[model samples]
Target: MLSNKNIIVTGAASGIGAQTAKILKQQGANVIGLDRHPCTENVDQFIQVDLTDPQSIDDAVAQLENIDGLCNVAGLPPTMDRLMVMKVNLLAVKYLTENLVAKMNDGASIVNVASMAGIGWPQSVDAIKDTLENATFDNIESVCDKHDVEGPRSYFFSKEALLVWTMRERWTWRDRGIRMNCVSPGPVDTPILKDFIETLGERAEEDMKVMDRAGTAEDIAPVIAFLLSDASAWVRGINIPTDGGMSSHVMEQMHQFAK
Candidate 1:
């Protein structure tokens, strides 16, 4: 579905990012992989990037042209430093996407990897908007402090902000036929799965009990590949939960839906 496309997949070193790159390549895309670590297998080209650093992102973006798709799959788990989590998961994504949009071909697609943690965005709209307006590379610390985005809250807040940002930008490039969307996976079985479990503690344990099994990268990557392909040209500004029914279960409990 992605034949001859020039696609970019960040966090392409491992987990969902790595698998997504593989699938994109299998579908005939010329995959450009970006990650902090070296990844030489699934992608046609590898660009080393530190998502926490704007200059590194800018340097990587400078090397690209005629991009057909971008998958913002690189992210940090909640166990990492709180500030670094916010930077990698939220700030860097905004910077990279804003910078690369101009270079993308018309009708290009951008897919962000969000999380089920963001499902409570409605409860945090005001905070999300405030952060979106005030947070920057220069003053992220103050903004994060103002919003209480410390500890595991950093991860949740980042995903919430990302979901809202994606929706707001749905039509930003509509004139050029470009679109933005996201995938929110539940506790997936990846290298960082333990990190999430470690961070959320009892909540993570309860969620695992409710889930049939943790989702694999295999379950999530195809949905990302679809969003990055022409097949989903009409799917814009939506978050598809590729979480093996965990999202539905959460909503069921949230609203007290009849069993």
Candidate 2:
């Protein structure tokens, strides 16, 4: 479905990013893989990048040609430093996407990989709005400091803010026919699965028990591919939960009282 297209897949070194890159390639796309680590599979080219560094992202984007799709699958787990978490998972994703906007084809699509962890965005809507309105690389630090985001909270908040950010920019590039969307996944079996287990403690175990199994990179890649394809031409500004029904289960509980 992606034949002849030039696409970029961030975090292509391992985990979901690697899997997504492979799928995109198998579907006939010329894939450019970007990551801090070296990726040896499923990519036509690799660009070393530190998503935490604006200069690195700038340099990476400067080398790009025509971009047809962008799969933002690279991210840090909660075990990383709080500041780095925000820089990579949120700020850099925004910066990198913005830099590539002009380089992208008019029919291009952007798919941001968010998490079920972001379901709590409602709790920080006010702060998220402020960041969306005014925060930039020059002032994101102050926004983080003002919100007192730290540790695991930083990871959660970054995704929460990212989901909101995705929705807000859904139409920002409409005049150019560029579209943006998000995919929020539940616990996934990946290189960093241990980090999630370590961070969430018993909460992670409880979720595991409820679901048949943790998600695999394979299970989530196709939805991302669909979102980035022309098959979804009419889809825009939507957040799809590619979570094996975990999201529906949560909603059932959240509204149990209504029943």
Candidate 3:
């Protein structure tokens, strides 16, 4: 369904981004792979990007000035300092989306790779709202410097901001006929796994026990491909969880505990 489309897959050098890029290409989408690390497979062209800097992101988007879609699959685990994670995941995203909005075809789609960790957004919406409202070009470094949100909070907050921003973006771009959505995966076995496991410690492993089985990058890529194609034309600004039943299971446990 994506044949002839121009798509950018950030963090495409490894893990989920790499897999998604490969799948998108297999279905005939023209793909641009962007990452800090160089990738060895599944890309038509590679563009090295440092998503933290506005100038860098602007330059990168300008490079893909003719692209049709974007898969914002780039992110860092909790191990990085809060500012770094937020800068890479949220700030860079805001800058790129604003700049790239003009480049996209009216029907083009944006697929952001959030995580199950971010579904806590409802309770934290107020905080996220503040974060987004304050997202200025020069203030990202200061905010990260101030919050010191390193570790899990940085990763968590970044995804939450992404989820909310994309939803609002849906409304902002409704008149233009553009679409946006997010994919949330749980306990995926990727190169990032070691970082998550080490940073999250025992709790991360415990969280995995609920699913009993981990998902593969292959499992999540197709759903992303679906959201990016004409098949999902009517879909807009929804966060789709592809974590088997893990997210639902978490809800169940929360409900039980509330009792």
Query: What are the candidates' C-alpha RMSDs?
Result: 0.8, 1.4, 2.0
In terms of TM-score, the best-performing candidate is 1
Regions more than 4 Å wrong, model 3: 141-150, 257-259
Per-residue accuracy of model 3 over 154-249 as CA lDDT, tens digit each: 898889889999888886777877788999999899988888888888888888886868889999999999999998989998999999888887
Candidate ranking under lDDT, highest first, comes to 1, 2, 3
Per-residue lDDT tens digits for candidate 2, residues 18-92, read 999989998999999999999879899999998888999999999998999999999999999888888888988
Model 1 lDDT tens row, 1-259? 9999999999999999999988998999999999999999889999999999899999999999999999999999999988899999999999999999999999999999999999999999999999887788878988888988889899999999999999999999999999999999999999999999898899999989988899999999999998988889999999999887888998998899848
Tell me how far the alpha carbon of residue 207 in candidate 1 is from the true structure, in angstroms, after superposition.
Answer: 0.8
lDDT of each: 0.94, 0.91, 0.85
| Model 1: residues with Cα > 4 Å off, grouped in runs | none
lDDT pick, better of 1 and 3: 1
- TM for every model, in the order presented, reads 0.98, 0.96, 0.93
Backbone clashes, each candidate: 0, 0, 2
For candidate 1, give the lDDT of residue 196.
Answer: 93
